[model samples]
Target: MRASLIALVLALSAVPAHALPPPCSGGQVYEDRNGNATRDAGEPGLPGIKVSNGIDIAVTDAQGEYGLDYVDGRTLFIIKPAGYDLAVRPDGLPARWRNLQYHAGPALKHGGIPQRQPDCTHFGLRPQAAAATKGELDVLLFADSQTSSVKDVDYYWRDIVQPLVGKHGAVLGLTLGDVTNDDLSLYPEILRTTMSLQAPWLFIPGNHDLDFDAAGDEDSLRTFRHHLGPDTFAWEEEAATFIGLDDVIYQPGQTPSYFGGLREDQFAFLQAYLPTVRKDRLLVIGVHIPVYEPGARGFRPADRERLFAMLEDFPHVLLLSGHTHTQRHWYHDASTGWHGLQPLHEYNVGAACGAYWSGVKDAEGIPDTTMADGTPNGYARLRVRAGGAYALSWHPARGTDDSGIGLHVPRVLRKGAYPAWGVFANVYMGDAETRVEYRIDGGEWKPMKRVEQPDPRLLLENMRDDTADALRGYDRSPEAEASPHLWRGALPTDLPEGEHAVEVRAFDRWRGERSARTSYRLQVGEP
Candidate 1:
């Protein structure tokens, strides 16, 4: 994994500088025809390129010159236009944005996005092949990798990232938020680890990824901008436009310091920017917190309504959020201000940290890290087709691909003991619509009842942790929760005193059929 990651960095066409950008008073999206970072005389400005102040968007005129009215406390960025690639800095952060420092913001504890306040904001865009911009997108999504410690970071690499190194051919990638638990200083290592992917990536801010010392919400992400590019920005490909926003609102003295909501600046940007986005394309909005749902606390209702109103015009939009370790899919209806022709699909992705990286270690010295909801500590792959079509699949971090289902069965049962034992299937991505069935010894396939209960697999691990003479690992697995994706079937214990095969099959709406196998032994007592 280390070697491959190193090779990936060396393979990139160019790398960005480690430091953040200064104020871009004005700039042009000129073609870097000469290959120099600067605009030589022959290099012409590219017209129709879009730029923004995190509020209003401006398009480059025929001469490629563009400007926008300044909005205080927002970064300045150029939307990566089609047929052009962003000229990135050496640090691998997207070079499309210029840091706009207020200097008036409270003295942020984490040194809010450095207040260098330079004059020039001119940026160069490299010419890209037309073929590269017109194809489908296989994206890598790590909605949450909230590594709290050095050990956690190491575990992130081994448990979640290492296995999928070169196998996942994701052309684009982004981290939803909670990039780190609280150690903002770990940003550098996080960047290096992601650099192994060798893909242009985006990052948004989360509650945990906050500067607790900052006095106000506006300055909470000072540390984040100093490292990753913009907390709110957009990147467009042929099939879709990917927009990531810092949706967490911090309240200093509130019971919950932060809430799931958008800022006024974000609304301004979306209102201006959405018009330019082609209605035919897919719209993917990534944020740290799940968009406010009925009865969901902290997420402001008004903000969610306004957001839904803004998105009401688009038909092919998908909402991606992270924060909860559990995974779920919600179809937004009129009840939540979504009056679109079809219900809005919001996929609350599973966390890569998998319940804060808790649980016992596996043979590879990595934590089991299964989420309380039974989703494994892994990442997601989003495949978007040419005509605004997309499908999703969850890849577990541990290895053996057993149909995306984890089965728990007692190793031994009393022979013919009232036929009371049963099998539990943790279908990681299963939802209410999923159909699961189980069969024994190639007998008739019996329907498995959908059940909401703690995954017995994790329950056994919890028991092991509680009964261990000494410590099992750094910590025990999290207390199991009623998993939305779990299914149960009563196993017949009326078989002969021998091993019996149990096979469980699940029908995934998108990925089709998948199956897993386990066996149980019926033993008789000695007389």
Candidate 2:
């Protein structure tokens, strides 16, 4: 990821020697029209590009000159404007910001943060490729890479990242949060591994990615800022505007604690920044904590309502979050303070760590890290088109195609069984608008009820661990929880003694279809 000597020097020298206007303490935002990643003589400054210090928002002047006073060691990043793209590292990580650390606090055990110079920092942006700005975008979404050790890091790359190296059409990658498991020091290695995907990786800060030694919530992200850019910022692509916020608030003490809620500065930042976004563009918000409360200790209710009120003017919005380690979908309607025509969709995505990389080891020496909800440990793909329309699909880490469907049924049953049995389909992305059905022996399709219940496959897996003779695998899978995407239909028990075919099909609201098959053999006599 090294540039030529001359280009590197030119890029470095672009920052002004002296500080600019009072608010604009940083350097200039010049146009790298030729896309060589260097500031040339003729490339003029681009105006009206929004930049932020995670609290105050500033826009570039006609000369592309902008700045902000040093503000509590926060990352200073530009909101990538329409028609322009930031220079990227060879591996496709965006090189759009300068990490400004005025104070070095406690010595970092892991990552290193660069200290700011006496003057402000400078940023350069290049013109976007025509295809990128043509109103279509695909983004790769990962939640909870959460590597805790060197071995976990290896597992993440070999099992999770390697399979998806170049498989999708994603131009960029966004990891919702929990990039590491309480080990701030692993940021460098994790960042290195993630950059291998050859796409610009944008990260939000999770509760685990905190500095336990920090005195308060404000200073908790110091180490994260040292490795990645700001914990909160915004960037625009095509007809979509993406904003990532750090919602984890740390409280320092003997037993460190944190909660889900946006800070005062973050709210101020959003209040100032969101107005500049075009109303028609798709507004995509990424947060570490789901806006909707998942449990007693979930996101703060008042904060979520306030955020909804702020978004009322915009008709197109989707929120993405990760923390539960389970996959589920939540809709915020009038009861949730969202008065939009449709409920605000919040996708609490599954973790890339997949139950913290637990369960039995597979043949490939990788953990069978399926989520507690029976959803596979994997990432998500979001396809954003013009006019604020989008589609999402979950991609499993291993096995199966892009069907995003899991099936649970009995292998055999009695011809005239006394007890009733049913087939369950755990469609990972199914929503209220989804149509799910099942058919037996090529008979007519019968509708399956959308029921919020524990996935039977995960329940059985958990049962194996609970009723084991002795210690089983490395660790037991997570306890099964009620899942929103599960569908069920009763199976016929009086069928003749024969092997019968069972098929399940689902039509998702996002114009996607999935089908899976399994067999049930019925015997004439009882065992």
Candidate 3:
């Protein structure tokens, strides 16, 4: 994949200075069965694949040919058909589209009119092996690898990327957004690091990945496009249809700001595209921003409402996003304008560079970048069954165990005093359906109350930083925010003065029970 990308770049760079092709008005979609990356005799053409030019949609014919009225400045791409996979660059980026731009060097206009390309720009697809077509797929999800400098990139590789280097079980990978921190030039390095995972990776643009100097939202991602592919595209794997939408709208000016909302063109694209998907397949939408408002920010309600309506008919659907740098689970139903019988489940997966890679360095010289919500900076695994059933789990960057519960308890509490202490558990991938229970010293298990509050561990970490005489680490971590996966239960105050074990067991809807244990001491009264 890497070699193919380098070759394509060299080929594009070698185009004669004066020999620009006519406007690209059409293309062909051929099957490259021989793995030669080109059309050959006896290789059949693929039909029913959707091709688009931003505002208009076209389908390829039985001959694998497609034509569209030339539209300068509009990106041209094909919606990868189900049961097939596109060839990707070494960095796991899918090479399923053509830019249609004539120029190829740095002198190319930034946001000015895009140079037109020649007609008959074609796309090719390599057949996926039958073994690769297993109805089940494991997708790796990484969010907010917001590395700001070379050192930060190194930290990302050492701490986050290196752990999964040779574990190639995942069929696909996705970065929710913010692949880098404002420096678009670092995309190559980031891509190279991601390539180590050896899975086809999909990326969504975050606010930090934008070319802020661009004139408007339409061109704010020029630099991102030069490195990555189209801002929006879709593909399929097994029983799921994956759609990536660029929902960040750049407001260019002296004090530019980005908002989360789909542009009219994106809405049009979905309107034309969703009807083509089979109803039984799970619809997984990936965006950088959450659809519903979070505190004072988030995507526009109108845009979210329209999107929900579009998926109302689909029984199985999931939305994945990452921008807040926090891990959370949300359910949108009638109250949230979702018309589907089953509420839409949105998983705001945690970031790879937790707390922006801030905190003290570890023994390996990697930052102890735990997210503000107490989720360790890590990646997620999404397992989708052949029948559209799915399960999501998070893996800490350095742990081998699958215990998803993080327990917090005071080291010593006064015996016979009021029950002022409580046991807190942060169930990383938990949702409403998850059940959490706790027991003390092998006593009867009691259910814990789910709480929408900051993780106690994170709050303690924040306190430690706030009370320090000076900065304690590379940077102070972000303030603790209310975490959606937290649960709390009062600890018994009558226990004898001695060390006692506290066990927390959590049962997720899909993943079975997982238990974690911590010990706390009950001390004789002093105060």
Candidate 4:
């Protein structure tokens, strides 16, 4: 495995950086007319060449210079038209994606002031551990390290993941799924880069990482299994029994779609296997798509039921998964009077490819898609204790200047039934006595009413869904599951609206007084 990874990077070293063609204006197209990126003598720009900014698309000018207003630090790249090459930086950043400080792009700043790079890193993992030890370990989860070309792999390292070398305390690493985009051949380079983190790494199957040329799902993961050991297996560490499942269900001609189930024999194997394992030990279920996600693109209800039935009786279970390119936390409580098992502690770790690698880049050149609960491209470091209790910490791959201080925004606001501007804020900190406040448009801060005697477990669990399963994509209504501990109040009606700010600050378990502020830009009606 190590040798393959080394070979992959060595191969990528051969791709050379090309100069960019001169910038073109709207209504024209530019090409490597001289077979070079630079616009040379007699190289005429082509009109009608399309340039895009994710949502908006425009054409280039006859002079080959195109202009469209853009967020400077945000990721900007041509869609890479067929038969044309994009100019790449020395480190391999696509020519259009320049001005990045580090690979993850640039940081966000407002009004000539650097804004809060949310500490998306560092959340509390379960199976509480007071200290780090050999037996107690945390797994670094990565999803879809897919690169289209060898040079693209260099971009991932130079721009995205190369910063994790000699990271302080992570024990093992696991790539959740999609190790490659479509080139199963590129797995070596991806693995080699990750292995540079100096930890034992494991790989899982994503749809793209599968062998489409194979006849069926069973054979699809054959190459993957050979590269990363058994497709379905378990490892027993001191804290928990980590079970890896080959849940990549493939359909013929569908390419990368989930439409199958665990083989009958694997189901039987797990049934027999679970009996041999200690029931008291915590079971960390690692899979790709979550069993219960808020989108239609997740698991089927029946599939979840089957998996739940398998471990329904087991206590101290935490399901760890990442497929949805978003961050969410859900917990189950038997005492909460909720129906069904509630799939306790359903955490959807945002992808390393945050928002499918979308969003604006930062000064460091990485996208902010991996923001806290909607932050930047990052990875979670879980610390599992001796008793199976753990805490989670997020590390922004591109944000921090190696400080490892990620954003900690326990408060998120949602507009309620008042004016279009009326808002309610949900605060999620570990402290029970922490005071919370909100201010709009630099107005006076107002104290929020707090309800005492709330269940911490239930409080944390309820935050995942504040609406019905239909609306919030959960099994219950948000009102029913709403925790009174999370402050909810109306916005002042007298205040005029334009661009307002909502900030929530509280002392958490770690950071004494952490806050998350969001800008709300509203337009008022004509008087």
Candidate 5:
């Protein structure tokens, strides 16, 4: 009798008296190394990582593990970190850090990383319709739209953000951090403008967005979270899992403006969630600061190893970020194993505000938004295909008519190879006259190609104001005997073969010579 009663009790327990249908099917999961809402490797489950299929309040555990039982089809994602970067798969999905040689899909999906496609497509790339089954989806990327005050906000709207309002194609749009220029209050205005995008818009914090009054590290971003919601969170769209993290950890005594490390809370959150990522969907990480090195800033050697180790297993991963306000592409080879088998694509986008709104205003009354390195003020569009192919393009803001941004002569000797040797380049001049040249081992500076095409908008900012001379320095002079937008050069062969310095100079159609020539280092073959 006793054994039968015990068996009966066990059976009863197995059959939940009320068989609530499983929450949702096809839901996604991720490995959270840190249990905090952030996706770091230390802390456990967090307060705000987003989960769908009926919105169960999701939090990570002390062990950084979370299992939303029966959430099969819902999208699960992490809030991206601020200073850190997120990894992405080729299909526009978020790539897991582990096994990252390729995506997590079938055998046909894997391949070595290739050079990133340029962002030359239309200023706006549409996302695949939610119902569409065949082609890839699309995502929109904007680097720092950092605005310091209401006036800057106006510039953003009138010059850049306003133009993107009602467009379609990308299901979601991401701003790569530095949403404001020390004005957290402007976040709402920023969102209001971004909401015009008609898609889910997400943001990451930048060094300028923190609070200067927080008394302790625990509450540093209190006002920010209270207003901006969670600093980091995730969402799923179509076949991709998206994680947003707050990597801007503030030091106890440092001024809020100082930038240093990722908070332990975020790491705790990631530890709890990473293991639960769904096997089918691609992972897309959206963060503000770059996990990889920006050419301008060199490398963040301390956090690199920790970050790589936490995400080493994922097969498909792409990291997108903006901080340097320049255009750069970084590719990591598989030899050192910084990540899994997949090669990581680190895209550091140029700023939307364009050199801190540095130059003169055009007919639109907006400043010329071009970087010192020559990347014009613009936003990027990322497209993700269902089969796992992704592409990127840029949409430059319309600026001046005299000059614009375009490709420089392809370097025979890469940048920095020769200090004195420089290349001349130009933009927006309407098939205008141009020239180029170089010398190696003290050879003559021979002219190269004078390629010209329709100038992208970013390359043509603020042409109307001949009266004010704010950005007059940035103007290219076509007649100074030396081109501001063009370079003439070949590396001096006398330098060491391993790598040498190369200098580039340019003159633009505006008849204004640049303040200085641009220079970069190049690698030479050992004889």
Candidate 6:
């Protein structure tokens, strides 16, 4: 009788608790052989694909059946196994997740997710005809397309997106966050603009993308999720797995509504997800805020430490973020709780809408929204290869020259004067260890000293803004700030009277040599 009772108890427990608001659920990940997005008869299930409840993960069984426990107002999304892709939804995003919660909460300022449910529990994936099986793929990286107004959106389109409509050979594209500058209404147009690029574009939420009316972090991105798929999601490529996480924790009544950190749910997701990541392939994580806090804990230390611990096992990992309106590369070591064999690299990607689109206009009517470090508002490309190797390169939205580096040479220098004035090369993607050299008048290439000084190019613009009788453009360029990727080489004022050609070359570790040229004229005397 006891054995029978125990068996009955087991069977009872096996049945999902319908009493819970969110009942336990089961679904199958299947190959859509007919491409109908429906599980027709005779369709085969794909095994071992991971499904998640935004916190916990469950792998499909041999027959591709998976189950998850009840979680109130939770959405279930699949981990998008390599070589297979989720079908695009009507909204033009990958349909990897299904929202379990059918009703909307209190009305929100940004119009939180609607009341209707769109997707069913079952996920359908199609095998790629031309998948990147060789473990080599290029990803386009964009951040802070923080369009505030329609004009700004047009600017983003013309400057950032229009040029690359069909120009790229990228397999995927990822925007770090801040899709809009607090205006949630523009989400549709933004998605449409991005999808035109013809790649599986992914996005995460930024602080600016928050629904401030929401009570806490959990509800902060409701509108965002409704439009941009899951704020935290994982995509599998042949060479790596790209994880997009919403790390902005919202504090309801705080001075700053959100801060950079991971919540328990996000931590839970990471803990459950990281173990499944392949150690041999590269792991690219995209978040809005940078991991390192330049100020008084811009990012929570405890959270970073915990995340570092979780990621230490991965031999190769790359963190990409874009909150800061500038570009920089950070290497985390023992000081940052990263004890990995090699230092961890975090590329704090520059803003796509550089400096909040607050700069003078260029010739094309696009704002020359150069970053504080003088990096022209642009996007970056990440080239990932097999065996955990990757290269990064930045592309200026409008480039007058092919060289990635920008040069600032004095128009005229007095003859026989001290060569105090030097040519400043703002290597937009340069690091402190980058080898930068400059040659004058086709002379021998001389090493340039790396300096943490403002780029002269922007300094000149600052002077222009400061001295202008009236507002120059829609807005003035940002004040010059110290740049970490700048190099300086003193030009020879003694060079006779003719204009001397000045060429600056930066030996990039990844994309190799990039050189820019300018000229300085020698005059009789200084004004």
**lDDT of every predicted structure (CA atoms):** 0.82, 0.83, 0.82, 0.51, 0.51, 0.86
Instruction: Summarize candidate 1's per-residue lDDT along 1-527 as a digit string, tens digits.
Output: 99998888886535543232434556788888755568888888888888887777888898888876644456788788656677767777667787766445557666667655556567788877776776577898897799887888888887767776787677778898999998888888988887677777888888889988887888888788778878888888888898889988888777667778888889988888888887787899999888843343456889988989989989799999888898888888988778999999988889988878888787878888889887787888898887778988888775657378999999998886876779999888788888999999999999999999899988888889888999887878888899989999998877889999999999987789999999999999664
Question: Which tens-of-lDDT digit does each residue in 381-408 have in candidate 2?
Answer: 8989898999888888854566778988
Over the stretch 38-125, how does candidate 6's per-residue lDDT look in tens digits?
A: 8889888889999988898989898888988745466678899888877777766777876666445658887777664433378888
Question: Against the correct fold, how does model 5 do in TM-score?
Answer: 0.56
**Winning model by lDDT:** 6
Clashing pairs in 6: none
Please write out the lDDT profile of model 5 over residues 345-414, one tens digit for every residue: 6667768886787665567677765665555677777777553456565567643222233433224443
Ranking, TM-score, top scorer first:
6, 2, 1, 3, 5, 4
List model 4 lDDT by residue over 1-527, tens digit each.
99999998987676543222222222234454433455456656655444443224444566655565533222222322322334433322223322111122222111111222211111011121334334467778776566666755765685556776665457567777766676766766776766667654656576666666665555566456434544455545566676666666776576335542455545654675565555655677777766664334445556666666777767667777776554556664443222344446755665676544433344655433432232345676676666657666555555453222222222322323234233334343222454766676667878755543332333333464443253332122112233323553355434444555666655443345556666554444443
Candidate 1 residue-wise lDDT at 337: 78
lDDT of 4: 0.51
Select the stronger candidate by TM-score from 2 and 5: 2
lDDT string, candidate 3, 1-527, tens digits: 99999999999889975464555588788887766556788878888778887667899899888888865456788887767777665455676766666554233233433454456767778878898777777899989999999999998898778878886488888898999998877888888888888887778889888876676788777667766767888877767898999889888663437678899998898888888887776789999988865443478788888888898998899999999888888899887789888879999989999999988677788777778788888888898887779989898886645698888999988899899789999999887678999999999999999998888887887899889998878887778888778899899879888999999999977778999999899889766
Ten-residue stretch with the least lDDT total in model 1 = 13-22
- Candidate 3 local accuracy as lDDT? 0.82
> In model 1, where do residues sit more than 4 Å from their true spots?
1-24, 34-36, 71-73, 102-105, 292-297, 525-527
- After superposing all C-alphas onto the true structure, candidate 3 shows an RMSD in angstroms of 6.7
List of clashing residue pairs for candidate 2: 24-67, 25-68, 110-185
| Clash tally for model 1 | 9
- Name model 6 segments beyond 4 Å from true: 1-24, 117-120
